[model samples]
Target: MTMADDTDRYGRVSRVLHWGMALLILWQFLSAGAHFLLGDTAVEEFFWATHKPLGLLLFVLIFVRVLWALMNVSRRPQSVNAAAKAGHIALYMLLVIVPGLALLRQYGSGKSFEPFGIPLFSGFEGDETPWMVAPGDLLHSWLGWVLLAIILGHIFMVVWHRRSASQPDVLPRMWR
Candidate 1:
């Protein structure tokens, strides 16, 4: 109920950031899925159009969420265990890295990126910077799929915990 986190649960801001990012990430995956399975169709194009801008927004939100987490570290609920802590760390890392690679690729391509009509960079006239583009090209999609797998694992754990009598229902910490 409070704006700031307490030892028992996440605060309003944390929950908002957590749930908001979850929804955004879900949308991103939908876009990716459509692009993969239904390429060249209206569905893919419609979803793909929102991908870049939404990714940028997600990157910004994750940055803010990390800062907020740090600020509230002492007051926030403790991780259930080391595994839970590590899982969260992995999620955060992927959240940052995935978009970061995309941004790097965008920059290297020297193509004008105007996500949501806000120009982040202008296009250049020469060849793309191979170094910046390479990592993304090699790992972006693969790691993105890995991130999605990890996310599914995360959700599975949540459900497992919620259903197990011996385990704690941690959802209430973030959910109202």
Candidate 2:
């Protein structure tokens, strides 16, 4: 699909951001699962450490992607159908909101917010008040599962469209 801009279907920058974010998301989920399965050991600690920083990185990448998308709107692949379009929008919204709510949960619990060893908020004492940690943790956990569900749904739709509709190149365009 040609556009007014003289760029490849996906362009190098977009492809980089897309894959980078995808890898980070995968790492986030796996690390979280490891934390649960391993349970308070060094391995769990190690994975948790990676989780916060990686999540923060994903947040930053999302910002970059938003800017890139705004600047290079014409270069994005055309939507295959209305469902695809809705799914795209839902994915974007979830990506942005999920991390944001996680961050908010950290903040609202009066926990330190750190990204890459840099504290987003510093020197804050945690709340001893009941329900502070519990609610935040619940929301964070539930939203994480919901995000995973949406991601799985998105992948299924992509595969279905590609295989059934003979649009095998649909996903490749985002990396072209």
Candidate 3:
């Protein structure tokens, strides 16, 4: 269904990408937590090994999403206010940047860049100095947390807009 916002409800491709990435992100977070709790056992190592591939998948999906968004900018829902616009932009930016940095950190640590079992870069080597790896790791982890915060804020705002404002169907526009 088309939305009153003038955007066609998100097409099948967009919906698939959106929901697929969401699941991947959830898996990543859960896997990370599992690694933390389970330590370096086989299960934890397996989860850690999966992280790079999943992250790469996210990176590619974000790239596709951004390109799709750019091509269909005119069809996106209009923001109800400046705050909404800024928040949306921030979410988009984080989606693009966070995965990118995570991939970079993997590379910087001389690890393989694998996504979904496909090796983007194998036997990759970078500055082995602790300094280089440290900064990359720190930035990657910090940005990830920030991205999570932004996502939560985005959700909260959407819920607020739907419940407190007259627009009870704000989220459906994205589906549209």
Candidate 4:
């Protein structure tokens, strides 16, 4: 029950953020899936409404998690291998980039954003910023799906590593 990350396993705060983000990401994918697979139906409508607010929430959570991760970097367990380390870095990058691009697009589109009524964006008076909107429109959904694929790969690697020839189960570090 450590409160900070140690060399052997993640601490309570890290575990909490890791698992919390997992659930949130799962919900986000569900929302995306509904939007992609169900389109204009009631299910899509229901899920889509939550997507924006949830994305903002995930963004904030990730920001905090990154700061926490930085604080605990020296104390965290070593990566099992280069691949594991790269995968982790990629995951973090995509987590930030996907939502980051979306928010950028939101602001650039000159549409007011007040998720949970916080007034994040104040809206503009002319045409949308094509640059911001373009990158987001081009990469957001695509990269989002890629992120999902990477996450699936991450899950597989976690389980696969549990049976690795050289180490203990990696799952326990984050899960237990």
Identify the leading candidate in terms of lDDT. 1
lDDT of 2 by residue, 141-174 (tens): 6777778888898888767766875565466666
**Model 1 lDDT tens row, 83-150:** 99999999999999999999999999999999989989999999999999999899888989999999
lDDT of 4 by residue, 110-159 (tens): 99999988998799899999999999999999999999999999999888
lDDT (C-alpha) at residue 78 in model 1: 95
Tally clashing residue pairs in candidate 2: 0
What is candidate 3's CA lDDT for residue 35? 78
> Per-residue lDDT of 38-137 in model 3, one digit per residue for the tens?
9878888877877867877787788888787676678765677888789878877877777776656666677665566667877555455465466567
Please name the candidate that would achieve the greatest TM-score relative to the true structure. Answer: 1
The residue pairs in collision within model 3 are 8-176, 9-176, 10-175, 10-176, 53-114, 53-115
**TM-scores of the models, in the given order?**
0.98, 0.82, 0.80, 0.96
**CA-only RMSD, every prediction:** 0.7, 3.3, 3.2, 1.1
Question: Model 1: which residue pairs collide?
Answer: none
Candidate 2, 2: how far from true, in Å?
A: 13
lDDT by candidate, in order shown: 0.94, 0.73, 0.71, 0.93
Residue 97 lDDT, candidate 1, scale 0-100 = 96
Better of 2 and 3 by TM-score: 2
